[model samples]
Target chain A: MKFNVKIEVMLKPGHSDPEGETTARALRELNYPIESVSVSKVYMVVLEAGSKAEAEKMADGMCRRLLANPTKDDYRFEIRETR
Target chain B: MKFNVKIEVMLKPGHSDPEGETTARALRELNYPIESVSVSKVYMVVLEAGSKAEAEKMADGMCRRLLANPTKDDYRFEIRETR
Candidate 1:
């Protein structure tokens, strides 16, 4: 079966987000009343696996091995069968 | 009222995704059977607006003004009430 996975990777709280802060500043400068902005990365991947359980395991492994930084980032993913 | 807005910005089809390509190659090297990977940016913004309609308008303006590139990127957003 083919599984489509969506993964979101975000920095843990207390970490400074320069890009988001800069973005917010730019927006406020443009006269939009905004409190704060935070940014994250989303990954959409397509892969082959035998079953849903196997696909979930593979997705988890991918996150641990390559998608996120253990010390600084938190990541989660959702999987769905693809035609 | 305060609104939490989630915005996603992605490269439109036909644009090269060097980051996604490099990530997929790294995952494959680690022995994962992955077909393709595409990455997008997600922004979580908190701001004050008079009502849902106003919040939506503000979010849309943000996307149009800075969150996405008109020629190469597509963006969508979701807004929800927050304490």
Candidate 2:
């Protein structure tokens, strides 16, 4: 079976987001009336697995091991069976 | 009023996703049985706007002008009123 996995990884609260801050400043300069900005990475993975549960498990493991930094990032994911 | 905007930016269908491909290769090397991978950028913006519609409009404009490359990337956003 094959599964499609979507994972979102973002910096934990209180972590400094320089890129986001810069973007917010730029928006303000453009007169966008923005208060703040936060950025995240979304990963879409298509993989072969025994089942949706197995796919989710593998994706979660991938997040913990490589996709997210435990000290500063948080991650979440959803898995669906695919053709 | 304040609005929370979530924007997702991704490469168009025909564009090559080098980062995603590299990540997928790494996962395969780790024995994850992955077929392919795609990556996107998600922006969480907290801003003040006259209304949700106005917020959405501003966010859409932002995506078009700066956040996404019109030729190779596509973007979508949702806006919600925030306290």
Candidate 3:
């Protein structure tokens, strides 16, 4: 079966997000009246694995090695069985 | 209106992704029986702006300046009015 997994990674509180902050500043310049703006990184990974346990292992490996910087960002994920 | 913007950034074909490649290798070690796996980055942006045109402008700016490296990534986005 194929599983669709979505992972989100975001800077931990007190961590500088110069990119997001710069973006918010630019939006304000455009007269956006921006109430709030938050930016996060997302990953969409599709994997064909034999079993749920194996899939979970793959997901964990993916997150630790590439999908996130554990020291700077917190990550979360959702997995959907797409047959 | 509040706009929910989803941005996807991907390495252009032929671009080397050492991180993702390393991840794939790790998955293999886990006995995933992985037929194939493709990974892409996703961004969920919530922005409260005054107008759609301004929102579009902000989105473009965000993508070019930070969300992606134009030289290495191809990006596409969707904007939905959520409120």
Candidate 4:
């Protein structure tokens, strides 16, 4: 079966987000009434797997091994069968 | 009112995604069955806006002006009132 997977990787709270901070500052300068901003990476993967369970497992492995940094990042993913 | 906005920026079809290609290669080397991979940027913005419409408008402007490249990228955002 083929599956479509979406993974969101984010910095853990308490970790400083310089990019977010910089963007927020720029937004403020541009007069947008923004309180704060945070940024994350989202991965869209299309892959072949035996089942939904298998797809999720593979995505989780990908996140742990390469997509996210354990100490500072947290990751979540969703898997759906492709039509 | 305060709104929480989530924006996703992605490369349009036909545009090259080097990062995605590199990651896909790494995944394949790791022996995960994969057809293709694409990556996007997700921005989480917390801001004060007069209404949801205003929030969305502001986010759209942000995307057009700074967050997304007009030629090769597309963006979408969702705004929700924060409790």
lDDT of 1 at A45: 92
Residues B1-83, candidate 3: write the lDDT tens digits: 78888778888878887766665676667654444444566666777767777778777877787667988998888888885
- Give the worst 10-residue stretch by lDDT in candidate 4 chain A: A25-34
Off by over 4 Å in 2: none
Error of 2 at A45 (Å): 0.3
Per-model TM values vs. the true structure: 0.98, 0.97, 0.58, 0.98
The true-versus-predicted C-alpha distance at residue A30 of model 1, in Å, is: 0.8
Query: Could you tell me which 10 consecutive residues in candidate 1 chain A have the lowest summed lDDT?
Result: A63-72
What candidate 1 keeps of the native contacts, as a fraction, is 0.93
lDDT of 4 by residue, B1-83 (tens): 99999999999999999999999999999999979999999989999988888888899999998889999999999889999
Candidate 1 per-residue C-alpha lDDT over A1-83 given as tens digits, one digit per residue, 9 for 90 to 100: 89999999999999999999999999999888899999999999999999999999999999898899999899999999998
Q: Any idea what lDDT model 4 has?
A: 0.94
For each of the candidates, the C-alpha root-mean-square deviation to the true structure, in angstroms, is 0.7, 0.8, 4.4, 0.7
> Evaluated on chain B only, what are the TM-scores of all the candidate structures, in order?
0.97, 0.96, 0.82, 0.98
Q: Show pairs that collide, candidate 1.
A: none
Q: What value does the lDDT take at residue A47 in candidate 3?
A: 78
Q: Write the per-residue lDDT of candidate 2 for residues A1-83, one digit (tens) a residue.
A: 98889999999999999999998998888889988999999999998988778887899999998899999999999898876
TM-score of candidate 3 on Cα atoms, chains taken together: 0.58
